[model samples]
Target: MGDPGGTDYAVSAEFYDLLQAEPDRRRAERWFAGAAGRARHGIVDFGAGTGIVTRVLLESSGVPVHAVEPAPAMRTVLMSRAAAFGADRRARLTVHPGRAEDAGLEAVADLAVAANVVGCVEPAARRALWRAAARALVPGGVLLFDPPPVGLPDGIEALEGLGPVRMGADSYLADVTRVPDRGVLRMVFDYRVERAGLAVRGAREEFPVWPAEPAVLVAEAAQAGLELVAAPHPDLLAARRPHG
Candidate 1:
Protein backbone atom coordinates (compact mmCIF):
# COMPACT_ATOMS: atom_id res chain seq x y z
CA MET A 1 0.00 0.00 0.00
CA GLY A 2 2.34 2.68 1.27
CA ASP A 3 5.26 1.00 -0.43
CA PRO A 4 3.88 2.33 -3.76
CA GLY A 5 4.42 -0.63 -6.08
CA GLY A 6 4.11 -4.13 -4.66
CA THR A 7 7.46 -5.02 -6.17
CA ASP A 8 8.33 -6.85 -2.99
CA TYR A 9 5.63 -9.42 -3.63
CA ALA A 10 6.33 -9.74 -7.37
CA VAL A 11 7.81 -13.21 -7.52
CA SER A 12 6.13 -14.50 -4.41
CA ALA A 13 2.65 -13.64 -5.71
CA GLU A 14 2.56 -16.86 -7.69
CA PHE A 15 2.87 -18.99 -4.55
CA TYR A 16 1.00 -16.75 -2.13
CA ASP A 17 -2.27 -18.66 -1.74
CA LEU A 18 -0.50 -21.95 -2.09
CA LEU A 19 1.70 -20.98 0.80
CA GLN A 20 -1.02 -19.55 3.01
CA ALA A 21 -2.43 -21.94 5.59
CA GLU A 22 -6.13 -22.28 6.28
CA PRO A 23 -5.64 -21.26 9.90
CA ASP A 24 -4.20 -17.97 8.79
CA ARG A 25 -7.26 -17.31 6.68
CA ARG A 26 -9.52 -18.30 9.56
CA ARG A 27 -7.83 -15.86 11.90
CA ALA A 28 -8.29 -12.99 9.44
CA GLU A 29 -11.80 -14.15 8.57
CA ARG A 30 -12.86 -13.88 12.17
CA TRP A 31 -11.96 -10.22 11.96
CA PHE A 32 -13.60 -9.92 8.52
CA ALA A 33 -16.82 -11.47 9.76
CA GLY A 34 -16.91 -9.02 12.61
CA ALA A 35 -16.29 -6.12 10.25
CA ALA A 36 -18.97 -7.36 7.89
CA GLY A 37 -21.45 -7.35 10.72
CA ARG A 38 -20.47 -3.81 11.70
CA ALA A 39 -20.03 -2.25 8.30
CA ARG A 40 -23.30 -0.70 7.20
CA HIS A 41 -21.96 1.24 4.23
CA GLY A 42 -19.08 -0.53 2.51
CA ILE A 43 -15.53 -1.85 2.91
CA VAL A 44 -12.34 -0.39 1.46
CA ASP A 45 -9.66 -3.08 1.25
CA PHE A 46 -6.07 -1.97 0.88
CA GLY A 47 -3.30 -4.18 -0.36
CA ALA A 48 -5.76 -6.64 -1.81
CA GLY A 49 -3.05 -9.13 -2.66
CA THR A 50 -4.33 -11.81 -4.99
CA GLY A 51 -7.83 -11.30 -3.55
CA ILE A 52 -7.11 -13.53 -0.60
CA VAL A 53 -9.22 -11.43 1.75
CA THR A 54 -11.25 -9.83 -1.03
CA ARG A 55 -13.16 -13.06 -1.77
CA VAL A 56 -13.88 -13.55 1.89
CA LEU A 57 -15.23 -10.03 2.22
CA LEU A 58 -17.47 -10.52 -0.82
CA GLU A 59 -18.76 -13.90 0.36
CA SER A 60 -19.41 -12.81 3.93
CA SER A 61 -20.35 -9.18 3.47
CA GLY A 62 -22.96 -7.88 1.09
CA VAL A 63 -21.57 -4.36 1.22
CA PRO A 64 -19.74 -2.89 -1.74
CA VAL A 65 -15.98 -3.49 -1.58
CA HIS A 66 -13.38 -1.15 -3.04
CA ALA A 67 -10.08 -2.98 -3.39
CA VAL A 68 -6.82 -1.11 -4.03
CA GLU A 69 -3.84 -3.04 -5.30
CA PRO A 70 -0.67 -1.71 -7.00
CA ALA A 71 1.25 -4.74 -8.13
CA PRO A 72 0.27 -5.73 -11.64
CA ALA A 73 0.99 -9.37 -11.05
CA MET A 74 -1.02 -9.40 -7.82
CA ARG A 75 -3.87 -7.34 -9.27
CA THR A 76 -4.15 -9.68 -12.22
CA VAL A 77 -5.07 -12.56 -10.00
CA LEU A 78 -7.25 -10.37 -7.81
CA MET A 79 -9.39 -9.17 -10.71
CA SER A 80 -9.38 -12.62 -12.26
CA ARG A 81 -10.97 -14.05 -9.15
CA ALA A 82 -13.46 -11.22 -8.97
CA ALA A 83 -14.38 -12.03 -12.56
CA ALA A 84 -15.44 -15.58 -11.68
CA PHE A 85 -17.83 -14.57 -8.94
CA GLY A 86 -21.55 -14.41 -9.76
CA ALA A 87 -22.53 -11.18 -11.53
CA ASP A 88 -24.21 -9.74 -8.47
CA ARG A 89 -21.21 -10.32 -6.25
CA ARG A 90 -18.85 -9.35 -9.04
CA ALA A 91 -20.65 -6.04 -9.45
CA ARG A 92 -20.05 -5.23 -5.82
CA LEU A 93 -16.27 -5.68 -6.04
CA THR A 94 -14.33 -2.78 -7.53
CA VAL A 95 -10.60 -3.14 -8.05
CA HIS A 96 -8.38 -0.04 -8.06
CA PRO A 97 -4.96 -0.38 -9.61
CA GLY A 98 -3.03 2.03 -7.42
CA ARG A 99 -1.67 2.64 -3.98
CA ALA A 100 -4.24 2.62 -1.19
CA GLU A 101 -2.77 5.88 0.05
CA ASP A 102 -3.86 7.46 -3.24
CA ALA A 103 -7.28 5.89 -3.65
CA GLY A 104 -8.96 9.35 -3.39
CA LEU A 105 -11.91 8.17 -1.37
CA GLU A 106 -13.68 10.48 1.07
CA ALA A 107 -15.84 9.08 3.85
CA VAL A 108 -17.39 6.34 1.75
CA ALA A 109 -16.81 3.23 3.81
CA ASP A 110 -17.61 2.01 7.31
CA LEU A 111 -14.77 -0.52 7.51
CA ALA A 112 -11.28 -0.59 6.02
CA VAL A 113 -8.92 -3.54 6.03
CA ALA A 114 -5.16 -3.50 5.40
CA ALA A 115 -4.27 -6.95 6.59
CA ASN A 116 -0.72 -8.26 6.71
CA VAL A 117 0.46 -5.28 4.68
CA VAL A 118 2.01 -2.57 6.87
CA GLY A 119 5.19 -4.50 7.56
CA CYS A 120 6.13 -3.94 3.92
CA VAL A 121 7.25 -0.34 4.37
CA GLU A 122 9.02 2.07 6.70
CA PRO A 123 7.43 4.56 9.10
CA ALA A 124 7.03 7.44 6.62
CA ALA A 125 5.15 5.33 4.12
CA ARG A 126 3.13 3.84 6.94
CA ARG A 127 2.16 7.36 7.96
CA ALA A 128 0.74 7.91 4.49
CA LEU A 129 -1.33 4.76 5.00
CA TRP A 130 -2.79 6.06 8.25
CA ARG A 131 -3.59 9.40 6.69
CA ALA A 132 -5.20 7.76 3.69
CA ALA A 133 -7.31 5.47 5.81
CA ALA A 134 -8.41 8.38 7.93
CA ARG A 135 -9.45 10.29 4.83
CA ALA A 136 -11.27 7.36 3.26
CA LEU A 137 -13.20 6.37 6.38
CA VAL A 138 -16.31 7.92 7.76
CA PRO A 139 -16.27 9.13 11.35
CA GLY A 140 -15.95 6.09 13.63
CA GLY A 141 -14.93 3.93 10.73
CA VAL A 142 -12.50 1.25 11.92
CA LEU A 143 -9.29 0.22 10.24
CA LEU A 144 -8.13 -3.32 10.92
CA PHE A 145 -4.54 -4.43 10.47
CA ASP A 146 -1.69 -6.37 12.00
CA PRO A 147 0.71 -4.48 14.22
CA PRO A 148 4.39 -4.44 13.38
CA PRO A 149 6.87 -6.07 15.72
CA VAL A 150 8.82 -3.74 17.98
CA GLY A 151 12.03 -5.40 16.89
CA LEU A 152 13.43 -8.23 14.91
CA PRO A 153 13.41 -11.70 16.40
CA ASP A 154 16.26 -14.17 16.23
CA GLY A 155 14.75 -16.93 14.12
CA ILE A 156 12.98 -17.89 10.95
CA GLU A 157 9.22 -18.32 10.53
CA ALA A 158 8.00 -20.78 7.96
CA LEU A 159 4.57 -19.24 8.33
CA GLU A 160 3.30 -22.33 10.16
CA GLY A 161 4.56 -24.85 7.59
CA LEU A 162 3.23 -22.57 4.84
CA GLY A 163 4.41 -24.86 2.15
CA PRO A 164 5.71 -28.20 1.01
CA VAL A 165 2.28 -28.08 -0.55
CA ARG A 166 1.96 -30.50 -3.42
CA MET A 167 0.76 -29.33 -6.84
CA GLY A 168 0.77 -31.72 -9.79
CA ALA A 169 3.87 -33.61 -8.56
CA ASP A 170 5.48 -30.31 -7.53
CA SER A 171 6.03 -29.06 -4.01
CA TYR A 172 6.36 -25.49 -2.80
CA LEU A 173 7.70 -24.21 0.51
CA ALA A 174 8.50 -20.85 2.08
CA ASP A 175 9.98 -19.26 5.17
CA VAL A 176 10.09 -15.72 6.56
CA THR A 177 12.95 -14.26 8.55
CA ARG A 178 13.79 -10.78 9.74
CA VAL A 179 17.12 -9.04 9.53
CA PRO A 180 18.00 -5.63 10.95
CA ASP A 181 19.54 -3.45 8.30
CA ARG A 182 20.25 0.29 8.31
CA GLY A 183 17.98 0.94 11.27
CA VAL A 184 15.06 -0.93 9.69
CA LEU A 185 14.01 -4.55 9.71
CA ARG A 186 14.30 -6.46 6.46
CA MET A 187 11.54 -8.99 6.07
CA VAL A 188 12.90 -11.77 3.93
CA PHE A 189 10.71 -14.31 2.24
CA ASP A 190 12.48 -17.35 0.82
CA TYR A 191 10.60 -19.70 -1.48
CA ARG A 192 11.37 -22.86 -3.36
CA VAL A 193 9.50 -25.30 -5.57
CA GLU A 194 10.58 -28.85 -6.21
CA ARG A 195 9.70 -31.48 -8.76
CA ALA A 196 10.93 -35.02 -8.41
CA GLY A 197 12.66 -33.90 -5.23
CA LEU A 198 14.74 -31.40 -7.21
CA ALA A 199 14.62 -27.66 -7.01
CA VAL A 200 12.68 -26.26 -9.99
CA ARG A 201 12.13 -22.64 -8.99
CA GLY A 202 13.09 -20.45 -6.05
CA ALA A 203 13.09 -16.79 -5.06
CA ARG A 204 14.04 -14.58 -2.16
CA GLU A 205 12.10 -11.36 -1.69
CA GLU A 206 13.18 -8.62 0.70
CA PHE A 207 11.15 -5.74 2.07
CA PRO A 208 12.20 -2.98 4.45
CA VAL A 209 9.79 -2.74 7.35
CA TRP A 210 9.62 -0.34 10.25
CA PRO A 211 10.79 -1.68 13.58
CA ALA A 212 8.55 0.78 15.44
CA GLU A 213 6.28 -0.61 18.15
CA PRO A 214 2.50 -0.54 18.48
CA ALA A 215 2.71 2.76 20.31
CA VAL A 216 4.26 4.31 17.21
CA LEU A 217 1.25 3.26 15.19
CA VAL A 218 -1.13 4.69 17.77
CA ALA A 219 0.80 7.92 17.87
CA GLU A 220 1.10 8.08 14.09
CA ALA A 221 -2.57 7.37 13.57
CA ALA A 222 -3.47 9.98 16.12
CA GLN A 223 -1.63 12.55 14.05
CA ALA A 224 -4.00 11.67 11.23
CA GLY A 225 -7.15 12.10 13.39
CA LEU A 226 -7.43 8.43 14.25
CA GLU A 227 -7.51 6.98 17.75
CA LEU A 228 -6.56 3.50 18.85
CA VAL A 229 -9.48 1.30 19.82
CA ALA A 230 -9.46 -1.93 21.76
CA ALA A 231 -9.18 -4.67 19.19
CA PRO A 232 -10.78 -8.10 19.58
CA HIS A 233 -7.31 -9.61 19.60
CA PRO A 234 -3.82 -8.42 20.53
CA ASP A 235 -2.25 -9.64 17.30
CA LEU A 236 -4.36 -7.08 15.45
CA LEU A 237 -5.06 -3.38 16.09
CA ALA A 238 -8.05 -1.17 15.41
CA ALA A 239 -7.95 2.57 14.90
CA ARG A 240 -11.02 4.74 14.39
CA ARG A 241 -11.26 8.02 12.50
CA PRO A 242 -12.70 10.73 14.71
CA HIS A 243 -15.63 12.91 13.74
CA GLY A 244 -14.52 16.44 12.96
Candidate 2:
Protein backbone atom coordinates (compact mmCIF):
# COMPACT_ATOMS: atom_id res chain seq x y z
CA MET A 1 0.00 0.00 0.00
CA GLY A 2 1.23 3.46 -0.88
CA ASP A 3 1.15 6.54 1.32
CA PRO A 4 -2.34 8.01 1.02
CA GLY A 5 -1.18 11.46 2.07
CA GLY A 6 1.08 11.78 -1.02
CA THR A 7 3.94 14.27 -1.17
CA ASP A 8 3.02 16.50 1.73
CA TYR A 9 6.74 16.98 2.26
CA ALA A 10 6.71 19.18 -0.85
CA VAL A 11 4.77 21.68 1.19
CA SER A 12 6.48 21.06 4.55
CA ALA A 13 9.95 20.88 3.03
CA GLU A 14 10.38 24.59 3.63
CA PHE A 15 10.14 24.08 7.38
CA TYR A 16 11.48 20.55 7.61
CA ASP A 17 15.04 21.43 8.55
CA LEU A 18 14.03 24.14 10.97
CA LEU A 19 11.43 22.03 12.73
CA GLN A 20 13.66 18.97 13.17
CA ALA A 21 17.00 20.73 13.35
CA GLU A 22 18.63 20.04 16.69
CA PRO A 23 17.04 16.73 17.53
CA ASP A 24 17.79 15.19 14.12
CA ARG A 25 21.34 16.44 14.23
CA ARG A 26 21.99 14.89 17.62
CA ARG A 27 20.35 11.66 16.56
CA ALA A 28 22.37 11.46 13.36
CA GLU A 29 25.57 12.07 15.28
CA ARG A 30 24.88 9.39 17.84
CA TRP A 31 23.59 6.73 15.45
CA PHE A 32 26.12 7.18 12.66
CA ALA A 33 28.99 7.27 15.14
CA GLY A 34 27.97 3.90 16.48
CA ALA A 35 27.55 2.44 12.99
CA ALA A 36 30.88 3.84 11.86
CA GLY A 37 32.73 2.24 14.77
CA ARG A 38 31.73 -1.20 13.54
CA ALA A 39 31.44 -0.91 9.74
CA ARG A 40 34.72 -0.62 7.88
CA HIS A 41 33.32 0.83 4.63
CA GLY A 42 30.18 1.53 2.59
CA ILE A 43 26.96 2.67 4.30
CA VAL A 44 23.50 2.80 2.79
CA ASP A 45 20.89 5.15 4.25
CA PHE A 46 17.34 4.27 3.31
CA GLY A 47 14.71 7.01 3.24
CA ALA A 48 17.50 9.55 3.54
CA GLY A 49 15.14 12.54 3.73
CA THR A 50 16.91 15.88 3.46
CA GLY A 51 20.21 14.00 3.90
CA ILE A 52 20.47 14.81 7.60
CA VAL A 53 21.60 11.31 8.48
CA THR A 54 23.57 11.11 5.24
CA ARG A 55 25.58 14.17 6.22
CA VAL A 56 26.33 12.74 9.63
CA LEU A 57 27.50 9.45 8.14
CA LEU A 58 29.65 11.25 5.58
CA GLU A 59 31.31 13.29 8.29
CA SER A 60 31.63 10.42 10.75
CA SER A 61 33.43 8.11 8.33
CA GLY A 62 35.33 8.33 5.08
CA VAL A 63 33.34 5.41 3.64
CA PRO A 64 31.13 5.80 0.58
CA VAL A 65 27.45 6.48 1.32
CA HIS A 66 24.48 5.67 -0.90
CA ALA A 67 21.59 7.94 0.04
CA VAL A 68 18.27 6.54 -1.11
CA GLU A 69 15.18 8.76 -1.11
CA PRO A 70 12.02 8.74 -3.21
CA ALA A 71 10.40 12.13 -2.66
CA PRO A 72 11.36 14.67 -5.28
CA ALA A 73 11.33 17.67 -2.98
CA MET A 74 13.29 15.93 -0.27
CA ARG A 75 15.79 14.60 -2.79
CA THR A 76 16.30 18.09 -4.21
CA VAL A 77 17.06 19.46 -0.79
CA LEU A 78 19.36 16.54 -0.05
CA MET A 79 21.31 16.99 -3.27
CA SER A 80 21.67 20.71 -2.67
CA ARG A 81 23.03 20.12 0.80
CA ALA A 82 25.41 17.44 -0.42
CA ALA A 83 26.80 19.80 -3.06
CA ALA A 84 28.06 22.02 -0.27
CA PHE A 85 30.45 19.32 0.86
CA GLY A 86 34.12 19.37 -0.15
CA ALA A 87 35.20 17.55 -3.28
CA ASP A 88 36.42 14.56 -1.29
CA ARG A 89 33.23 14.31 0.70
CA ARG A 90 30.98 14.99 -2.27
CA ALA A 91 32.78 12.29 -4.23
CA ARG A 92 32.01 9.80 -1.50
CA LEU A 93 28.24 10.33 -1.76
CA THR A 94 25.80 8.97 -4.35
CA VAL A 95 22.12 9.84 -4.39
CA HIS A 96 19.65 7.10 -5.35
CA PRO A 97 16.31 8.25 -6.67
CA GLY A 98 14.23 5.41 -5.31
CA ARG A 99 12.83 3.75 -2.22
CA ALA A 100 14.53 0.89 -0.41
CA GLU A 101 12.64 -1.75 -2.37
CA ASP A 102 13.94 -0.56 -5.74
CA ALA A 103 17.15 1.19 -4.81
CA GLY A 104 19.13 -1.05 -7.25
CA LEU A 105 22.15 -0.85 -4.94
CA GLU A 106 24.88 -3.46 -4.88
CA ALA A 107 25.02 -5.76 -1.89
CA VAL A 108 28.23 -4.34 -0.58
CA ALA A 109 27.40 -2.19 2.42
CA ASP A 110 28.83 -2.97 5.79
CA LEU A 111 26.03 -1.09 7.50
CA ALA A 112 22.52 0.09 6.61
CA VAL A 113 20.23 2.47 8.48
CA ALA A 114 16.67 3.69 8.19
CA ALA A 115 16.46 5.97 11.23
CA ASN A 116 12.88 7.21 11.75
CA VAL A 117 11.74 6.03 8.33
CA VAL A 118 10.31 2.62 9.20
CA GLY A 119 7.20 4.16 10.70
CA CYS A 120 6.48 5.99 7.48
CA VAL A 121 6.08 2.84 5.43
CA GLU A 122 2.81 0.96 5.34
CA PRO A 123 2.60 -2.40 7.12
CA ALA A 124 2.33 -4.39 3.90
CA ALA A 125 5.48 -2.82 2.50
CA ARG A 126 7.52 -3.29 5.67
CA ARG A 127 8.49 -6.88 4.97
CA ALA A 128 9.70 -5.92 1.52
CA LEU A 129 11.69 -3.08 3.04
CA TRP A 130 13.40 -5.42 5.46
CA ARG A 131 14.20 -7.80 2.63
CA ALA A 132 15.68 -4.99 0.57
CA ALA A 133 17.84 -3.94 3.50
CA ALA A 134 19.06 -7.46 3.81
CA ARG A 135 19.86 -7.55 0.10
CA ALA A 136 21.89 -4.35 0.41
CA LEU A 137 24.14 -5.69 3.13
CA VAL A 138 27.19 -7.93 2.99
CA PRO A 139 27.29 -11.10 5.00
CA GLY A 140 27.41 -10.19 8.69
CA GLY A 141 26.50 -6.57 7.89
CA VAL A 142 24.31 -4.69 10.38
CA LEU A 143 20.95 -2.93 9.94
CA LEU A 144 19.84 -0.36 12.49
CA PHE A 145 16.54 1.43 12.75
CA ASP A 146 14.12 2.98 15.25
CA PRO A 147 10.58 1.70 15.46
CA PRO A 148 7.64 3.61 16.92
CA PRO A 149 6.30 2.92 20.41
CA VAL A 150 4.02 -0.08 20.62
CA GLY A 151 0.26 0.39 21.24
CA LEU A 152 -1.32 3.55 22.60
CA PRO A 153 -0.52 5.30 25.82
CA ASP A 154 -3.02 5.02 28.64
CA GLY A 155 -5.85 7.58 28.90
CA ILE A 156 -4.92 9.27 25.63
CA GLU A 157 -7.58 9.86 23.05
CA ALA A 158 -7.20 9.64 19.27
CA LEU A 159 -5.68 13.10 19.12
CA GLU A 160 -3.14 14.76 21.38
CA GLY A 161 -1.22 18.06 21.31
CA LEU A 162 0.78 20.63 23.22
CA GLY A 163 1.35 24.39 22.98
CA PRO A 164 2.81 25.91 19.84
CA VAL A 165 6.49 26.66 19.54
CA ARG A 166 7.41 30.08 18.19
CA MET A 167 10.56 30.68 16.21
CA GLY A 168 11.26 34.18 15.01
CA ALA A 169 8.12 35.49 13.31
CA ASP A 170 6.74 32.01 12.69
CA SER A 171 4.84 29.71 15.02
CA TYR A 172 3.75 26.10 14.67
CA LEU A 173 1.57 23.62 16.53
CA ALA A 174 1.76 19.82 16.33
CA ASP A 175 -1.04 17.33 16.82
CA VAL A 176 -0.95 13.53 16.60
CA THR A 177 -3.95 11.30 16.00
CA ARG A 178 -3.93 7.56 16.55
CA VAL A 179 -5.75 5.37 14.04
CA PRO A 180 -5.68 2.10 15.90
CA ASP A 181 -7.53 0.05 13.36
CA ARG A 182 -5.13 1.05 10.60
CA GLY A 183 -2.12 0.91 12.89
CA VAL A 184 -1.12 4.39 11.85
CA LEU A 185 -0.42 7.67 13.61
CA ARG A 186 -1.43 10.78 11.75
CA MET A 187 0.59 13.85 12.61
CA VAL A 188 -0.58 17.30 11.61
CA PHE A 189 1.37 20.51 11.82
CA ASP A 190 -0.16 23.96 11.50
CA TYR A 191 2.18 26.81 10.76
CA ARG A 192 1.66 30.56 10.72
CA VAL A 193 4.22 32.99 9.36
CA GLU A 194 4.01 36.61 10.42
CA ARG A 195 4.78 39.46 8.05
CA ALA A 196 4.57 43.17 8.87
CA GLY A 197 2.90 42.38 12.20
CA LEU A 198 0.27 40.31 10.46
CA ALA A 199 -0.06 36.54 10.22
CA VAL A 200 -0.16 36.49 6.41
CA ARG A 201 0.96 33.00 5.52
CA GLY A 202 -0.20 29.66 6.87
CA ALA A 203 0.14 25.94 6.10
CA ARG A 204 -1.18 22.68 7.51
CA GLU A 205 0.38 19.37 6.54
CA GLU A 206 -0.33 15.78 7.59
CA PHE A 207 2.18 12.94 7.92
CA PRO A 208 0.91 9.43 8.56
CA VAL A 209 3.13 6.86 10.25
CA TRP A 210 2.73 3.09 10.71
CA PRO A 211 4.49 1.69 13.73
CA ALA A 212 5.27 -2.02 14.00
CA GLU A 213 5.58 -4.25 17.04
CA PRO A 214 9.04 -5.40 18.12
CA ALA A 215 8.11 -9.06 17.96
CA VAL A 216 6.62 -8.63 14.51
CA LEU A 217 9.70 -6.76 13.34
CA VAL A 218 11.95 -9.52 14.66
CA ALA A 219 9.96 -12.09 12.79
CA GLU A 220 10.12 -10.02 9.61
CA ALA A 221 13.88 -9.68 9.98
CA ALA A 222 14.23 -13.41 10.43
CA GLN A 223 12.27 -13.98 7.24
CA ALA A 224 14.65 -11.58 5.50
CA GLY A 225 17.63 -13.64 6.68
CA LEU A 226 18.61 -11.19 9.41
CA GLU A 227 19.19 -12.19 13.02
CA LEU A 228 18.05 -9.73 15.68
CA VAL A 229 20.93 -8.65 17.87
CA ALA A 230 21.11 -6.57 21.00
CA ALA A 231 21.37 -2.89 20.19
CA PRO A 232 23.80 -0.67 22.04
CA HIS A 233 21.05 1.92 22.44
CA PRO A 234 17.57 1.24 23.71
CA ASP A 235 15.87 3.37 21.05
CA LEU A 236 17.21 1.41 18.09
CA LEU A 237 17.21 -2.22 16.89
CA ALA A 238 20.22 -4.01 15.43
CA ALA A 239 19.95 -6.99 13.13
CA ARG A 240 22.80 -8.80 11.40
CA ARG A 241 22.91 -10.90 8.25
CA PRO A 242 24.34 -14.33 8.85
CA HIS A 243 28.02 -14.71 7.90
CA GLY A 244 27.32 -18.07 6.31
What number of clashing residue pairs does each candidate have, in the order they appear? 0, 0
lDDT by residue (169-193, candidate 1, tens digit) is 8999977776777667776778998
lDDT of 2 by residue, 1-244 (tens): 1121124377767767766756787987876676765667689888888888888888888788988888888888888889898899999899887667777776769898887777777776677778888898999888888875666444324454433557766565444454444455665666556545567677777766776678989998899899999776778888898898
Q: Ten consecutive residues with minimal summed lDDT in candidate 1? A: 1-10
Candidate 2 vs. true structure, TM-score: 0.86
Model 1 lDDT at residue 191: 90
**Highest-TM-score candidate:** 1
